[model samples]
Target: MIKLMRIDYRLIHGQVAMAWTSAIGANCLLVANDAVSKDSMRITTLKLARPAGCKLVIKSVEDSITALNSGVTDPYNLFIIVESVEDAYRLAKGYRNIRSINFGGAKPQKDCTRKLSVTTPVSERDMQLLKELVNEGIEIEIRQVPGDEKINVSKLL
Candidate 1:
């Protein structure tokens, strides 16, 4: 079963490797990012950052969806991580198991000037996707760590 689905540009770091993993009691860290899966150095870094005793599986977005839908991930407590709103939208749209999304870390877009309701920056397309997810009844929130208060995406919408 899925424990959580998170969107953080920095896929695995101290906050995720320690705090979120423990908070959700996740045993498997599934990183669904095509670019990271193809990059050997990134894979190595993410593996090193993963919490001890947890399994890390880095696969392309489509592959991750296949594994999830095929019930291959049913045996383990899965913590899914994606780097973009589009990727998260694809996963949650492809699989009904993903009921919530956490907007953890978003690096600002240098050219984006359209102000969004959220404190941080996001492209207009991404903001639209996020709003659509909320309309679909998927809970979305913003927070850096588990200890921080969850700011619902709907309220900001």
Candidate 2:
């Protein structure tokens, strides 16, 4: 079962490892990112950062979808984290079970044309994809942590 799907640039950090995992009662942290899956050092660092008692599984978006679809991760309460809106869109599109996404942190890009929040800077392309996701019935909530009040992305747009 997927407890939450969050898009945070800093994938498995203190906030996620401590707050979000406990808030969601998630036993598994699934990071769906192509780059992180291939980097040995990055994977090791994330594993080290994860809170004890929580299993960390890093896989590409496609592979993650395959695992979810094949019942490979059905036993655990899964918390899915992706780095970008593009990756979130890909995962949500591939898996119908992901009905909502929490936008945690997105660093400013050089091409950023708009600021969604203090931590989230969006390019025109990012805005479009986000709007499309909303239109497709995926709820978008902008919040730094589980205790914070959720700001609807629709109102921000």
Candidate 3:
């Protein structure tokens, strides 16, 4: 069971390993990204960065859906880490009951709008999909960590 879905390009960084996960008491991490899942070395590095007791599963979007959703009756807490907004959108589409998406970090890119040092560059299609998700009652917040003050995207709208 995933309590939160965080969209961070950096994946399991210091802030996530030390602060957010600790605060949320997330023992399981399901990283849903095609690129990272394909790269064994990157996955190994990410798993190593996580705390010793925490379990990290690096899988593609489809695989994550299958693994987490199957036989889940008690709703165990887990964290879903994604790389981009598009990936988040896709995951939400593939998975249900997804509300409150967290923006941890996105690399600065051309034509991006900066919010709390994180760059968000939305293409026309991406914006449309995001708007659709918002209309479907998804809450979006920009926060680096649990302690970091949250910036609600709805307020900016």
Per-prediction backbone clash count:
0, 0, 0
- What is the TM-score of each predicted model, taking all chains together? 0.94, 0.98, 0.87
Candidate 3 lDDT over 1-157, as tens digits, reads 6667898888898888878888888888889998999998998899789876887788898887776567452355688899888889888887776788987776555655434343555555556666777888998888877877888766654
Superior by lDDT: candidate 1 or candidate 2: 2
Instruction: Compose the digit string of candidate 1's lDDT tens values, residues 68-156.
Output: 99999999999999998888999998888788999887666875554343545788888899899999999999887888888888887
Candidate 3 lDDT for residue 35: 90
Q: What lDDT score is found at residue 125 in candidate 2?
A: 90
**Can you tell me which runs of candidate 1 are displaced by over 4 Å?**
114-119
Task: Please identify model 3 stretches exceeding 4 Å from their true place.
Answer: 72-75, 111-121
**How large an RMSD does model 3 have?**
2.2
Q: Which is the leading candidate under lDDT?
A: 2
Please list all clashing residue pairs in model 2, or write none if there are none: none
Give per-residue lDDT, candidate 1, residue 26.
Answer: 100
What do the candidate models score in CA lDDT, each in turn?
A: 0.88, 0.93, 0.77
Give the better candidate number (1 or 2) by TM-score.
2
